[model samples]
Target: MRLLLIEDSAELAKWLAKALQGSGYAVDMAHDGQDADHLLFTQTYDAVILDLELPSMDGLTVLRRLRARGSTVPVMVLTARGELSDRVAGLNLGADDYLAKPFELSELEARLHALIRRAHGVSAPLITLGPLSYESVGRTFTLGGATLALRPKEHAVLEVLLLRGGKAISKEKLFEKVFSVDATTGQDVVEIYIHRLRKQLHNSGVSIITLRGLGYLLEAT
Candidate 1:
């Protein structure tokens, strides 16, 4: 998943970025509301972590503006406000969840997981397709009753294909899900990764078929 973190505190932002990255997420950071707003306009993120006490544009203003413009990306507000009124106001302005200062980093992480799950209509973490299985939170893939260790991008790309199992996925659509805009990757990179994955699948008699001018589809024998 790609997450946008809007925080002015460099220390906290860096720590959170590292934690999320370790958990198999792509993270982008913004120091203030202006920068955050600009990024929101430019790229798409699965979720947003907005700190209410931000400079230039307060988190509330940013939240309200984003909603007003009809962007429905999930957002969890992280701020020093823990009072009932503040929390109520944030919800009224379309904030999906809230986290207060001095909070356990675990709680913030959990809330984020919940937000993304709800957005994607997923209440569970396991994804199964024919003889293949995937555990989203664990970042593990099981193919043909054997465990496979895959790079993060490879895992993400395979998961997308497996989710669509019977449907053909265009390379453009796959790119949108696996690579964040800031990634220093070219369009052909997807082809390379899929090429590698195809070989691995072929070794086990599972097939990820390339559709010539189209993209790919997974077929299990």
Candidate 2:
């Protein structure tokens, strides 16, 4: 999934971004509230990790503006303040989850997974369709009770598809999520990956369908 991380502390932002990337999420970082606000308004992110202390604009203001604009993107507040009032204020301002500083990375990731799944209307960690099953926390995809082997990009592509739950995803969005900032390839790479995934998933009760102008959709046959 694509995530926007809004943090002002350089060292902590770097650590969090690295940990999140290692967990298979496509991450975009904003070091201040203005940039974070702009990115949240203009771009699409599956979820956001927001720090209450920020430069230029406070995180609560950003959150209020975001919700005021009718955006339902999941948000998790990260702050050093563990006070009850602060937590209640954040929740009232529309944060999906709250995490105090000095927390474990695993707990943060688990909270993010639960928040995103709830936003997507998925109530379980395991996603199943036909012979395929996906474990969110472990990041594993299996078919017919066996693990499915996939390259990194292939795994990313399939994960995005499954998260959308059969909805069509634009090729541009897929490229943005699946390819890295340093990737040298163009958007045409999405077509190649789709073709490869189709071949790999053949006869596995899952199929990748091209929707012409709409993009690609993954469905169970």
- In order, candidate lDDTs are 0.81, 0.88
lDDT of 1 by residue, 22-128 (tens): 76667899989998988888778789999998999988998998998899999999988889999999999999998889888767777787787667666678866
Tens-digit per-residue lDDT, 1-221, candidate 2: 78888999989888988888777777888999999899888888888999999999999999999999999999999999899999999999999999999899989998998888888888888998888899987778999999988876788789889989879999999988766544588999989989998998999899998898999999899
Q: Judge candidate 1 against the unseen true structure and give its global Cα lDDT, from 0 to 1.
A: 0.81
Q: Which ten residues in a row have the lowest lDDT in candidate 1?
A: 130-139
Q: Give all candidate RMSDs, comma-separated.
A: 2.7, 1.9
Residue runs of model 2 more than 4 Å from their true location after superposition:
179-185
TM-score of each: 0.83, 0.91
Best by TM-score: 2
Give the TM-score (vs. native) of candidate 1: 0.83
Choose the strongest candidate by lDDT.
2
